[model samples]
Structures are given as C-alpha cells and as structure tokens.
Target: MALAAFMLLLLPVLQGCAIQVTFDGASIPENVNTASVQLFENRAAYVNPVLSQTFTEGLKDRIINGSRLTLADGTGDVDFSGEITGYDTEPLAIQADAVSTETRLTVRINVRYENFKDPEKSWESSFSAYRDFPSEQNITAIEGELVDEIVEELTENIFNKAFADW
Candidate 1:
C-alpha cells in the first residue's frame, strides 16, 4: 500500500513535465521538417570523380536517418550546397632512415547552409577529414576505402553543425 501511494505521487510530478529525446540529440526547430542537398562539385586539385556524388548522397542519408527531416526535391526548410575544396596527400611519420612510414590523405569541403525559417541561424563553413595509410602501400589500392571513411566523418561533422547546434 505504501509503495503504491508513493508511485501515485511520483506519477503526478512526472506527468507534469514534458520530456523528449532523439538518437542524435538534435535540437532542430519544430517548424523545420525538410532539407535539401545540392550536388557537391569536385573542384579539388586532385579530383575524385565520384566524390561529389558520394558526399551529396552521404549527407542526404545522414539527414534522413539522423534527424526528422525529409529530403526535399529542390529547397526545403533548410538547404545545403557545397564543393570539394581540397584533396591532398602528405608524408607523415618520417623515420631515422629518412623514409616516410605513412601517407595522410585529407579531404576538405566548403559548405553553405541556409535555414529559411530563421535566416540568422544560417551559416557557411568548411569541414575536412583524413585517413593515413602505410607509405609502402599504393594509394590506388586504398583510395576508395580511405575516401569512404573520410567522407563518413565529414558527413557526421557537417550534420552535427547543422542540426545539433554544435
């Protein structure tokens, strides 16, 4: 009887408070329900022909899966457009033998985000990510894997910036 009384008291307090949660902890405005992503052009000095399409799709997937936003045909409550700005490889982990043990491949992209509901919340930014592989290994052999991994990270970063208020 005492336990039942206690439960009943707690229920009233809990019911008075509203709680909501999301997998990605996004705080998007309630009015914004749709998003659009333009095809990203690969303008990097080292062009990856598929990168632009891959990134555009990756972001579209992220928005759809991570948030409540629908993919709009043209422009939605929020819009995203960008281009691949840099794709470069550099030697790393030089040894006493004067030989590089690893090569780091970096990808950079410039993104423009617009929130039609609230113009002040809109912004433009650049995001990048990288992967390192053994210098002895040929880039062609690992380029696909590295690019996929880097793109995943880049997409997550961009998603956080746009919706998570990061």
Candidate 2:
C-alpha cells in the first residue's frame, strides 16, 4: 500500500517531464508570435468575383483562431501569401449512358509560408480541395455554397501545413 501511494504521488511529477502537446495539434515555434496573411489573388482561368477575398479572410481567421499568433498589417514573424491557381470542374460517376451523374468542382491554391524566425522551416506548396454535386444542378445556382465549403477545407489544409507541422 505504501509503494502504491508513492507511485501515485510521483505520477504527476513524471508527467511534467513529458513533451508538451497542444489540443489543436499546432506546434508553432515559440518565437513566432505574429503573422500576416496577404490577400490571395484569383489567377485561375475561371475567376469567381469574391473568391479572392473570401479565401484570404478564411485563411487569416484560421491562423488567428488556431494559434497564439497576432495579425499584422504587413509582414510578421510568419508571413503567408498565395494565389488561387486553379478553379475547374470535371465529370465524375459516369452513368450507363456514358453521361456524368456527378460533377466535381475543384479549387487549388498555391501557398508561400515564410517563418522569419526560422527561414529553413518556410515552404511554398499547393493545396486543393473538391466537392461533388449532382449533374442536374446548375453550377451557377450552387457556386456560392460550393465555394464556401471548399474554402473552409483549403484553409484547414493551409493552417495545418503552416502551424500544425502536418
């Protein structure tokens, strides 16, 4: 009983020596306390009027909310700048008649992340996400909703890549 009591008391002390982990999975460097997210320009073949602003804001929001970083008007310790590289559609799920039953909408963005505190950790990469809609639905009628969903997914990917080290 004495040994059991001693082990229980030592558990808390032992835990203090373990590696720290965050609930959000982010592993932002200690020196990186500020960040900047530039407006992402839409350079895709097909441009959506509000896509640039929407995507930029979404990425900013994700970083601010997910980390302990402050937003800066200009460059901060961490900088994020990117462009929408692709917005396209393709046919999926062909039917017996050789017609597509579903249409896939894909959005791709190229991201450049700079960590001034650690330049070696910075990277430039492209991220993409897609959604499928019924072939019968006109894209014009569902474009807004589809874009919102795609933006959310893209922002998560960007955040994870930049801060979560994933």
Candidate 3:
C-alpha cells in the first residue's frame, strides 16, 4: 500500500515529462507557421466549369482543418500552386455485349509545393483521384457528386504529402 501510494504520487511528475503529440499527426516544421494556397487553374481539355474553384477551396479547407498553420495571402512560409492537368472519363467494366457497364471519371492535378524555410524540402508532383459510376447514368446528373468525392480524396492526398511525414 505504501509503494502504491508512492507510485500514484509519481504519476503526475511522469505526466509532466511525457512527450506531447498532436492529434492531427501533421509533421510540419516548427518554423512553418503560415501557408498559402493559390487558385488551381483548370488546364484540362475537358473542363468542368467549377472544378478549379472547388479544388482550390477544398485544398484550403484541408490545410485549415488539418494543421496548425495559418492561411496567408500570397506566399507564406509554405506555398502551394497547381493546375488541373487532366479531367477525363473512360469506359470501364465492359459487358459481354461490348458495352461499358461503368465509366471512370478521373481528375489529375500537378502540384508545386514551396517550402521557403527549407527549399530542399519542397517538391512538385501530380495527384489524381477517380470514381466509377454506372454508365447508364448521365454524367451531368452525377458529375457534381463524383467531383466532390474526387476532390476530397485529392485534397487529403495533398495534405498528407505536405504535412505528414509518411
């Protein structure tokens, strides 16, 4: 009982010495306190009128919600600029009758990341996400929903690349 009491009293001191971990799992450098996200231009041949804005805003949202960095105007300690390079749909899962049972919609973005604090840590990469839907459904009817899903996935990928070590 005496040993138990001593251990219980030591717990608070041990807690004070424990390492703190952020719940978001972001591994951003301590000096990177601000970030900027440029409007992603739609350079794809098949342009979805709202894709550019949607993707840009989606990225901003992810950064704001997933990290402790502030969103700054122009360039910050970290900056992100990119363009939608490919937005295309291709037939998939063809049936025995030679007709596609599903169609795959893909959105690809070429991203350029700049880490002003450490230029060597910066990178340029392309990220893409897709969704498959029944071929019979008109794309116009489902495009918005599909695009939302794709944008969410793309934004997550970008966030992970920029902030998560893994």
Could you tell me the TM-score of candidate 2?
A: 0.86
Question: What are the runs in model 2 whose C-alpha is more than 4 Å off?
Answer: 1-21
Candidate 1 yields a Cα-based lDDT of: 0.91
Question: Which residue pairs collide in model 2, if any?
Answer: none
Task: Give the winner by TM-score: 2 or 3.
Answer: 3
Q: What are the TM-scores, per candidate, against the unseen true structure? A: 0.87, 0.86, 0.87
List where candidate 1 sits over 4 angstroms from the true fold.
1-21
**Candidate 1 C-alpha lDDT tens digits along 1-166:** 9999999989888655533235777777767889999999999999988889999999999889998789999899999998999999999999999999999999999999999999999999999899999999999998999998998999999999988789
Q: Say which candidate scores most in lDDT.
A: 3
Where model 3 places Cα greater than 4 Å from the true spot, the runs are 1-21
Candidate 2 per-residue lDDT, tens place, 1-166, comes to 9999999999899676533345789887666779999999999999988999999999888887888888997899999998999999999999899999999999999999999999998999999999999999999999999999999999999888877778
Question: Roughly what TM-score does model 3 have, to 2 decimal places?
Answer: 0.87
Per-residue lDDT over 25-63 for candidate 3, one digit per residue giving the tens place of the 0 to 100 score? 777776788999999999999999999999999999999
Q: Go through the candidates in order and give each one's C-alpha lDDT.
A: 0.91, 0.90, 0.92
Better by lDDT, candidate 3 or 1: 3
